[model samples]
Target: MNTRIAALAALFLAAPALAEAPAMTVMPSPGCGCCHAWADLARAEGYDVSIRETDVAALKDDLGITPGHRSCHTALVGGYVLEGHVPFDAVARLLAAQPAIAGLAVPGMPSGSPGMGDDPDARYDVIAFGGTAGAGEVFHEAGR
Candidate 1:
């Protein structure tokens, strides 16, 4: 009886840790301040983030991120690629939905985007790419 109680307590204690979100691996362009800021924001939002400085151009090319979809920083999480300063909510949606595509992108450093600045009026789209034809579609929109 005591053993059963201990087993139950252990399981309950471990449940939250087991359910934690997967770690995010971020590769930022060397010397890019915005990329570092974005990573900091992600960490503040409770994401388990790891950073690596690298040549972003080569990484983008290797990842098949089209020229139009390039960003200063790239991240890999839960088997999906995240390019640029994508908002945490967008990432959460992507993970929850697990859509059949390559990944999400916020494209260039748009003003008001995360790590860019707090521009309440900044408008941009989170683009989802690498589907059947490698075309991009709007995954989510932000800042009106």
Candidate 2:
């Protein structure tokens, strides 16, 4: 009975951490394997990812992912739009800080980016856009 009580206490202590993980819904272009790969990466990083195959172009437009900062997949998490293959760390930071920004984007797909095959040499910028239709501001640069 003491062991069982200890186990129950451990479970209760861990519940809050699990509950704090962000839930994300990703919309990827239909038949885009890379987008699927990206979504998988997000899941591995502990996000609750729900993927849907739809018209990504229309979705991007609707979400205000401007042409200059568009990618194959778009995700909604913590009330912010994440466009393209955004890095997991950036997402975590965004959620933790709850910045007043539109979202983060990787713009065009870079070879070394997550889900695009990690090519350590491939550098890319994660841009943060504010408001519903804000422009890109460099948030973080990877591989630098």
Candidate 3:
């Protein structure tokens, strides 16, 4: 009887820690409201989000985000870089799939993207970069 009680208590105590979501770090341009908005969006979606403000140009360069792949903000999640306002669902998918890629990028900020606005109909592509000589391919398409 005592053994059974101990087993049940152990399971209950470990449940919350096991169910905790992964953490995400976002580096956004200083004074960029949209970037903050996007961070809030990620937090709302169950990410343990942390935001840091920095020079966008220098940060982008440091992160190896070239001109074509540049965005207003950058994020690190599960060893992958998430550029711009990537959708929450796409992030969830990326973490679930655990693809062999550097990370996902949304490039420019689309009007209907997660932080830009709540437009479910907005069209965009989440790109996977850094796998093949720095070449990127589409990872997810919105409104498809």
Question: Which candidate leads the pack in lDDT?
Answer: 1
Residue lDDT tens for model 3, 1-144: 123323422422332321266677778887789999999998888877776656668656655677887788988766667889999899888878877676788888889898898798999888887655334888889877
How many pairs collide in each candidate, listed in order?
0, 0, 0
lDDT of 2 by residue, 1-144 (tens): 123323422432333234445567788888888888988888888877777666778667656667988888888776677888888888887777766676788988888898899566678999988553334678878877
Structural similarity to truth (TM-score) of each candidate:
0.82, 0.80, 0.82
Candidate 1 error regions (>4 Å): 1-18, 133-135
lDDT of each structure?
0.77, 0.73, 0.74
Q: Which stretches of candidate 2 lie over 4 Å from their true place?
A: 1-20, 132-135
**lDDT by residue (tens digit), candidate 1, 1-144:** 123323422422332321375677788988899998999988887777777666778767767788999889988776677899998888988888878777899989999998999575679999998755334878888876
Clashing residue pairs in candidate 2 are none
Provide the lowest-lDDT 10-residue window in model 1. Answer: 9-18
lDDT of 2: 0.73
Q: After aligning candidate 2 to the native by TM-score, how far in Å is the CA of 116 from where it should be?
A: 0.4
Pairs of residues at least 3 apart in sequence or in different chains that clash in candidate 1: none
lDDT of 1 at 14: 35
